[model samples]
Target: MSFRWVAGRIALAMLLAAGAQSTQAADFVDSAQRRVMLPERIGRVMPAGPTAEVLVFALAPDKLIGWTRPLSAAQQRFLPAKAAHLPVIGRLSGPYPTAGLDALRRLRPDVIVDAGPISAERSGFADAIQRQSGIPYIFVDDSIERMPLILRSLGTVLGVGDRAEDLAIYAEHAIDALRGRLLIRPPNERPKVYYGRRPDGLETALPGSPANEEIDEGGVINVAAGLGRDGRIAITPAQLRAWDPNIIIAEDRPFYDSLLHDPIWRTLDAVRYKRVYLAPSLPFGWIDDPPGVNRLIGLYWLSTVFYPDMTQEDLRTQVKEFYDKFYGDKLTDAQVESLMRYAEAKAGETRRVGGEPLVGIGAALPTPVPGPGGVGTGPAPNTGLGGLGLGPPGRRVPTGGMVPLAPPTPLH
Candidate 1:
């Protein structure tokens, strides 16, 4: 109801990395990837992704304008309870970008902080728009290696360099803590791991992807190495069999039942050995998607899996700190466990068929959709060359016909 009420609650949100009082602080932020530390305390902020939202919420709750809608059951479970009072900036799939020009003008936010830049709109100049609109724009990469740069950049823009520097130090220490436990070994000795990318089991990202980098950091051998270093690749059920990896990290297989009922997938050794692992959906995507600032949690989750003998006590505490700091919410022990389960990429027995990698960058790499950050519009799914026919969020596709983007939407 009152700004003060929201302020009292979110002053502790660590995920947002925001820090300000009332609305007095107003400064433009320019994050053109040339990140550096500075001394500015950004009063108002807009979240481009869940990670950015979390960052702002952690540091400055009263300052955050809005968050993306559909905050997932697990992610929402830990919200500050006051978030329900906030508006839905936009939905992830259904709505196009919700950072409205009018809203920015009305709110007159000092800066736009975007952490999720997909290949779709990587160079689309959302930053330039902020400049044109008399606001500063900032971009943070999804890689852990670059997060310190992002934090420092955000620090300078927000006049919270001390807090930002603390965060950078904390993040580095946290990552080092996990890497310290990893048992790096000969390539042959490392456990083979294959990661399924999304709702469908077939699509996967290769070794060079930031997704695989996190896995590689944990001392696990990615089975998808054969797929190449160019990031995600689609392969057949037969090719999967040929790989016959030691461990299968199955992703959000929305259609898990078919794998069991269908006779085709039974031949895989992973299914026979029952070494498959599963990662949580919804909230897990928060960690998995774009591998953002929140991905420190994902790194911890992997550490536990790769080194089953190690207890994740400290990591669990860190999760609590993060939830408290960013969302102003808390998770019961059980909820944290449940949230991490889906993040686990376990072994599964799935055989193969061969075809081109189902993953293709549509000719409309950054297809013009209509909405807050969109450029233009057309009828549903204006199928240009190599279009994925992504008509709308929940649009149903006739079975056996053409499935729109059988692969997972690009997380980057």
Candidate 2:
């Protein structure tokens, strides 16, 4: 070999070594400003929580290794075949941390992605996890207002820029439209709304709580704001009566159903006038169990409930589009009907508000009167109502491909 050829080979080797070093040291600064040196190609991703799981799944399902929690038979219907079957790897954060360092190492994920409020404590937690697991961990801000930006940022980190941009744009449009609508109506003119959680209807997302963002962004005043509390709080029926909201949205179907029969709840103007609405929680909670991108659909749905006159888009169309795009499920007419089964007030319950009858889907079925036990036994399945055969209050009957539905349980 010539001297010149050997010199050229040595130079090329040094250049390749430098390139490898650069790629190896490439760092991604997360929303918390913690610098994470990620792998050049992140193939397997483990979400730190449900919020991160949903966000990452939206951008790249193939890259997501597993779910933070197991999917119910019903929720599986709304997800991609592969995603629905992903093993339950447990969670890494929150009050209950199930995925230990051992599980993390066994999973061998390229990185751990967590999306939520970025704070010093959470940042330090990420640092600890990264150190213990010997895997790159990133914390991305999960604020509702910053969703578009978050999607784009996380997309870049996950190497799905195009997909991320598409979702980011969708989020941007949705948020911008909400802001525009809110601008049209002053805060005082907006509906005073109560968001009831759990089966009893007393558990509520306090003002400024992440769970309450859907209601807050819907241009309404949260009646619970006066409670001066943070996060979920329980209040007495007397307190709810005193605040008597213009509209009531419940997370649990049973709670919303009970409102029509419970003497105290029935006396409230919201129920008396049939202004009670049930927030959908099929594949995910529309209002907020995990408080993630799933709530985007809720934002549009809320417009129809609070200001029906202003919303011109067909709600059914909007819902199908969202499910198809985000959840990767094409909802059938039957499935859609099942979703909206009790979303609006019952047919006969609609009392005139401003001399206009509130239009709702399905025939006026008999309201379920309470049994001897005081719990209202839901009316028998009405096959004629587009497969909306009622099984029980706050539950969906499994028919065809539809699975029985219930409120989102904790991630335990």
Candidate 3:
């Protein structure tokens, strides 16, 4: 065949293939309000970032093509063997993308799922990727309150509606119950919380940022809200002192450790009053590193930390139940305890001021006392200890075995 003839034939074949794909695709509206032509039968899903990866894994582990990053030994212990061993494919969308166009072409995923805040920029990025790779891309809103809707919608698209509904209901109950408890105290009554990041504890998440979502929903005011919206920024010691928040939630273990002995930090009321708490990041960050569905558990944890008195359930049970349902791992009592050991309590210190016991310090107190914010009494009898338990038990997973990786087959 002539060179020109061969080139024409190749182009023709590509056109025909594109036409066939278009015919089989259906119009779907994503959370970004963009209309995307999604493949009718989506099998392999490419998660565009860490948030997308976690959301996809929670909804349909089998459909997920790969993880955005390799699972750590600690994370692998909490996940299913199949998921834990999945190859690490660099992310495609985010501040720093690692996945290249060649990688997407090789994977040839049925669809790309990007879960996070829906915005014009994200929609444009999805469009660009779709055009570049000739693959459909869908953005799902990962906002904490909108998670139920997102789960139900994405589940149906993935042919996992029943499972999605189960998770959605769980989320609904968790949110609703927590909201009811929050109604007990007005915004002023709630604590002023400062969420610190990094070893220096000077980096902080502002309002509308994913990192502070748990704190926003945790029935308290983010002291850093006045700084700005939607980004992590560094603050000076003067600014932190000016805010003088009643409670401090730190992301880095080293930062949390320093709060105990650092003189500069000791000047803050949160440190002096013993209201500083460390956020757990084992299998995943409890508050937000990826800002995914893992934060459903964070809502409960933060509530206990913010308002221990309003907590209604046991923290340890909640942790086990959340892990089994979302992570597919039935944690041993020891493992669960390890995750929560440093959350609310210190090893040797039961925080007290002048021989008077304070609330949510370390050990539980027989009588209710004023909490750090001076808003309410201590945690209810047997309620949250170390920010583990809060709110009512919605659903319980059967113990003594691994949680089923996939949802049960629905009855016709």
Candidate 4:
């Protein structure tokens, strides 16, 4: 039976209860950084970040009041329905725009959830908005290691700690269980893999990032390992030849044509092996954008791709359980397979070829595994570079795929 059948009944029940008590719960939106816990029935949730909006939809669709509309074409078509209804508050941090703080205040939402790092670096804005607007603002961290803690924090403030904890515990175990079942085949048998971002480049996660970690955990070697864990560095075609990976994954679809025409790329091992993969995008934004609790699903996608023979439903269930237990929604059977189906045809067909899939990298950086003052992706935001062996504190992944732990910025 479809999981949606069960989810429908749950949503229907919550929908009715939400209509009645939305006002009371709505106050959480006004508390401004104050911790709040909503009743089991989440009512009027106003997620502030794009990635957070998508996840909040997955978590409690009925409770959300709406979210800012998507800025990109990728999001408008494939993103969640609830997004359309939510009014855009513009950028949450910095200066508010359009409605800015004023409209957000008028909305009188219950909770303002943002995955962006706001407490340490962005806190001044958070504090100002909360104090000036009369709203409670809460920040959710996306550090894989801190997921459980963040989940509990979300639950505590959302008034669903019991349910949140219950699900979080389950999220941890289920991820472990799925990982356990994906047996590691010999390196010889495993296909050579590559994760390439668009604009015709291989910009991807550094080894310490969550996606790389996910790949490693799934027992697959990242073909780009030579690039080092620092992240997607610009590479020449000659460099790719040296790597000679069997699989090439196009992180974004926009660059497919350029990859097909590249003289070096056309003759690459991954091309010959027909291991070009295209990832699924709908709840748009790279799987890692604002990488939050939803990232567990990325691990699930990798397990099935690397070990298709060993894992039948191992990967599928990860999505189901994630949507079911947490989002209370079930993707249709077709939707489930659709998510990973494009992975094999990544570079797409120059004529004939197959596809492939998000490696999790930092999903577990307890501290800067790469550096000294090692700050794990904990809730605490570390902005200093020398101390943390990371980029300037407050600066994480910027316009590029992943930011390198470069030498700290120079002082004036």
Candidate 5:
């Protein structure tokens, strides 16, 4: 071969190789600030945790390989039939053994996405998984406030910009509505609330914890706010009594079931006055557990509960709309009512406990009625907070001790 012809052939090979490289992968920065070269057209993905699963499913369900956990029978009812049948792949975090690594290799996802609070340990775990599986891993911030940005960025990374934009717009609007309405309430006017987790209701997230972000966004004062704690903390009955919250929000069904019968718990003003409420948790927790996009609906539910008259948006209608939009499930009236049963029950219980219906701020208190014995037939003085069933006045709850924890730094 002529030297010029041979040189031309070698140059052609180099150009082809470079073109292939460009087509195969592209570099992007993730929430952990890691610059990762991922497939240009990512068609398959695995979620590193439950939060990641929800995020990916919301933006690109067609690309998701499976779920971190199996859908329960009830949870299955809330999802598309095909999604309900997705295999249980487990998660990389939490107490259980790291699951689906072998399946991950077999399935050969183009990338793995881990979303939630970014931390050194979590970043390291992502790196380890990438090294082990030879798959690119992308970490995305899962902070509730940053969700819109996250969705936008993840959309660019996953080649689903249009769907992500739609989700992001909805998220931004919901968050704006929540902040615009709730943040203006004076500290004293906000209902004092305690959020209890676990079946026993002893484990709780303090204010400033990512887990309690929804409670704060809802405009209610977290009774555990100023305790200067992060993450889940176990509260003794005595400590709970000391806080004496006006309202209680429990995630566990068993805890709500036993609240009235449990002697120690019944002593709480929330339980005694029927101000305790069960937060909905089915396909996913509406409040915190995994702390993902699921909490956007939570903000609406809580705001309605705390200040019903502030907006005319009906909770049932909102719930149905949210589920249909995000979860791909069109809820029946019965399902919507069941999801809101706890809030409805609380309202009914409050009336039965002889409290007047809750009135909006600046609204006049109802006139005292003459009782059978000629005594005023109004709720006992100081027993409620402006007829909202928020227990007595003068009980001090934390107002503004939210710690300023920065998003986790990326590991070098």
Candidate 6:
């Protein structure tokens, strides 16, 4: 054959090969019920939001291209060493800044997964990203009630079904146990809870907010229920006093400390009774912040605090196991203790009451001694109430309350 004819044949052969490779891709149905075509073998993946980042990390750490946000010094401690150095790729949801298309294109992720609420806007955004980058983007449902299924689905997509099943089973078991214990309790028996979202104790998550899902699942009556709102809302002291929650769960030390000392907060029943407790937040918040897989531990923690009698398992042991399995960190005794320091003392444990200190449940004190910031400096009065885990000392409070109402500026 002539040289030109031979070159023409080679070009046609290359085109056919390319078509075959394209046809080898697999198809996936995302949470949005949208079809996404992906390479049969996905190696590098990117999370489109904070929740996706945590979920993907637990199931396929090796597949993760980078984090949605930069890890802080404290957050790095809980994550694997390699994760500490991952690039900040930004996120696509919850008011967080979206990563630049150019930046994401350079990373060359095999696919992008946005795991959380499935809304039309989000679905459209994912489609737009895919069209712009020529990459597949999938949205995975991440409601608290659907955690196990989400895990299983992710496992299937990531080609890590065994690991995914393990995590999913754990999630299902925890949810079942929590439901069994909680559903049996009478409404009156369930403690009324208020989730303090910010340091001032003025901002809080209303009912239906994903951030408070664990608390709701734990069977505690969120005082903010029926508030006709979602996410963080500012409440006046009068509103808090009117609610008179039986327990107060705060996100950080400052908020907990404020409840102990803030003059207006002190008037509330939770403060007066020393029922305020801190929620653990290090690598991620156990209770809600980002409403991710990290909250799996929150289910156990809330169950223990709300119904110590019903929780047959030891809190410390369970926490250690969770950290090891999900976070890839095995916490030491000290670490565990620090995590639970603010948790309610077990039933019958001695607590300070009336500045005299009481061994068990006792009468309410007249007023706690005011500390700096109006927090009482003395040991909090023990009212025989239980609390969730305490956060580490000096944990920096992120801007935006437990849930940021607006997307934060992109770091990249």
Ranking by TM-score: 2, 6, 3, 5, 1, 4
> Would you list the clashing residue pairs of candidate 6?
95-407, 96-407, 261-374, 261-375, 344-387
lDDT of 5 by residue, 183-222 (tens): 5644355566788888988777764456776775665556
Model 3 TM-score relative to the real fold? 0.77
Model 6, position 274: C-alpha lDDT score? 66
* Candidate with more favorable, higher lDDT: 3 or 5: 3
TM-score of 4: 0.63
In every candidate, how many clashes are there? 48, 0, 3, 51, 0, 5
**Collision pairs in model 3:** 315-388, 315-389, 344-386
* 1 or 4, greater by TM-score: 1
Each model's TM-score? 0.65, 0.77, 0.77, 0.63, 0.77, 0.77
Model 3: per-residue lDDT, tens digit, 305-412? 776766778877888888888778888988987888778643322222222221211222323323346543323332211100112211111101011122222211
lDDT at residue 254 of model 4 (Cα atoms): 58
- Name the best candidate (by lDDT): 3
Q: Is candidate 2 or candidate 3 better by lDDT?
A: 3
* Deviation in Å, model 4, residue 193 alpha carbon: 4.1
Give lDDT per model, in order. Answer: 0.50, 0.67, 0.68, 0.49, 0.66, 0.66
Residues 220-316 of candidate 2 have per-residue lDDT tens digits of 5556554432367677777788767778888887888788877877768787777888888888888887888888888777777776656657889
